[model samples]
Target: MVQVKLFDCEHEQDLEEEINRFLSDLEHKQVVDIKYNIAALREAEDEQIYCFSAMVMYIK
Candidate 1:
């Protein structure tokens, strides 16, 4: 399994788009499974700054 973490995603749509892009890029590979999680956005110390995390898993 390969894990990819995406941070600072703007919204659900962005996350979905990124996932689709990744999957498309790996279309020719022997991927057995794929999963992802988007973490809630939180303040990043700087005012008006927020961030989120997405975790993706790929299995072969």
Candidate 2:
């Protein structure tokens, strides 16, 4: 089976940490693949927000 989820964070460190935590909770060593894309959202000339879309694939 395969599963995908989206994670959002303001900093890179937070995003990475959350991903790791999620993987750990799954406790599956046979993860097929993990992928993600990050984009910066602009609210103002000097303001930005980070959005991440993460996908996790594993064997059921």
Candidate 3:
């Protein structure tokens, strides 16, 4: 199994799109049983700042 995480302040849609792109690339490389999640979002130290986190997994 493999795991990956992505963090950004952008919207979930954008993040999901990026993650999908990544998964597509991995699929092209013959990776299988992949899973992913947008686990959390929270405010950063700065009030105007935001944080996003995602997790990805796959089985070799």
> 1-60, model 3: which lDDT tens digit per residue?
555544453576777787678777665544534344443434576445334446555544
* Model 2's TM-score against the true structure: 0.62
Candidate order by lDDT, decreasing, is 2, 1, 3
After TM-score superposition, the amount by which residue 33's alpha carbon in candidate 3 deviates from its true location, in angstroms, is 7.4
Q: Which stretches of model 2 miss by more than 4 angstroms?
A: 26-29
Please give, for residues 1-60, the per-residue lDDT of candidate 1 as tens digits: 555544347576777787677777665554554444544444667445334345555553
The global Cα lDDT (0 to 1) of model 2 is 0.73
TM-score for each predicted model, relative to the true structure: 0.45, 0.62, 0.44
Best by lDDT: 2
Task: Using lDDT as the measure, name the better of candidate 1 and candidate 2.
Answer: 2
- The regions of model 3 sitting more than 4 angstroms off are 1-3, 28-51
TM-score-based ranking? 2, 1, 3
